[model samples]
Target: MMDPQIERKLIEIMRVIHESDKPIGARAIADELNNRGYDIGERAVRYHLRILDERGFTSKHGYAGRTLTELGEREMNEALIADRFGFVISRIEEMAFRTSYNPETNEGVVPVNISYFDKDDLETVIEIVSYTAHEGYMISPRVRIIEEDEELFSLPPGKIGIATVCSVAFDGLLLKAGIPVEPAYGGILQIENRKPARFSDLISYSGTSIDPIQIFMSRRTTSVLDVLEKGEGKILANIRQINLSAYERAREIMEKVEKVGLAGYFPPGEVGETLLGAPIETGKFGIAIVGGINGICALEETGIKIKTNPVSTVMEYKTMTEI
Candidate 1:
């Protein structure tokens, strides 16, 4: 059995490798570790990497360094699940602060979710995304299709990737405009007669280890296509709390953002009033927007397999095209 301290170091190394888009050398990994406040040097990183390679958690590439194997990813994700609690909320806040997209100029970056599917399913995937976006159920109509050669990160063999703007981009815009926003929950917002009715289920962002949207998708909990066709079904959504003081500014920012092509259909509710059956606290209102993965949810409902990375990365707004 590995020593507890060794296991911790290995997990940290795997995390760094998992985050990289390409093979990372020991020197680079060591430098990254040091930046993260670890005292490990390149030689030590290389020594530990050998253990990872022997355990099949990583594969070494000549002169390039090492790439995390599938085992590594699974191990890392499952290793310290406790440490990942509330990670989603932290990710949202970080991405919101990192967002620099300027609707006026159509420049800067916005947070996005990435999904992968078999190359053969590309056309079907595009069709589903297009139909969902056209019906106005997605966070935005903007999307970026990544071919093998254009992939920003490694994808499984025979898989293609797509990037959709995350709903958090709205928070980013609001934050950029000096409006502080609080993400409350990710939930299943039930729709009735083509309007959002209430939340059927909710997972607090501060308590869950996995992305709630992913959880819902894995459980096949959404009826996104039904909502599009019959105007009544549960779909993925999230609630954010914003102070009433900045509500008007937030609204104006939303308008400018939508004008530039990202669709956010829901408006903030009155302070202390319920929005979609979720009660608002004093001095703050709730804003519930459809999850960006609604399109993918529709596809999943049809039994098409997809691998998703929610709030995966930020991409330039100008780089994505309208669906």
Candidate 2:
């Protein structure tokens, strides 16, 4: 659990550090508070600093005073999101979403924001809550197989990924960045290097549906359906031909989507049985021709990312550009 008020205070401090481009001290934060007319004292600021340090949100540097952790920076972005950024990022995540880094030299984290919600579906929320890991469901994806980087963070739903980070910015590999598609949920996520391989060798992930059965039970299907019915986006769903080479195999699904024209087909077989998440089989991506169809949906299902700590999020309210 988190202290909401304290969290807000921490975010305020983090924003100060971010904008300053220099280490910020508790005294500095105190002065800023006073300047902002908060009526808070230095003692209160010290207390807040203690809490931030304990939570790894702030660290004691050698001589630079204190700084926000990778986690802290990501959390602060919620404050940084501009009023209309939601629309801007959505347009981006659609064209291409890639996560690439080398573990031997790079261990930075990319922050991305995804929106997960039960706000409109209490019945669905109830079902998912009481939901246990399915028997054959292995909620675990076999395709999430590039098993080398178990310590890296996985992309969860409702995340706004921040790109361009290095070891100086974080301690692990950076994965994603950008904004979210609206009717979005909240906050951004930090993804670490999910594999030990280099960018040149890592297999590229093409966003496609790997769960056919889940189409009925999962939140993604519902979300896609909602977007389609409301025409929120030109969406494509239940895309099969997963495990496809971004250049070739997935083309089949693309062709079908072309004919169906974003209606999202049911896809052929038992998808999750042999596959799930992003199965990084590594060296085995066979040669296949680029399939078909141009740009299709605004968002493609990557994989199900669960919460590390369920943070309360106010649904799509603004963007980084707007705020």
Report RMSD (Å) for each prediction in the order shown: 4.5, 19.1
Task: Name the regions of candidate 2 deviating beyond 4 angstroms.
Answer: 79-323
Q: Local error of candidate 2 at 67, Å?
A: 1.3
**Candidate closest to the true structure, highest lDDT:** 1
Per-residue CA lDDT of candidate 2, range 166-244, in tens?
1111101111222111111111111112111111111222221111212222333222222323423212111122232
> Per-residue CA lDDT of candidate 1, range 103-205, in tens?
8778899889989888988889989898898787897777998887752455556778999989989989888889999888888999999888899999878
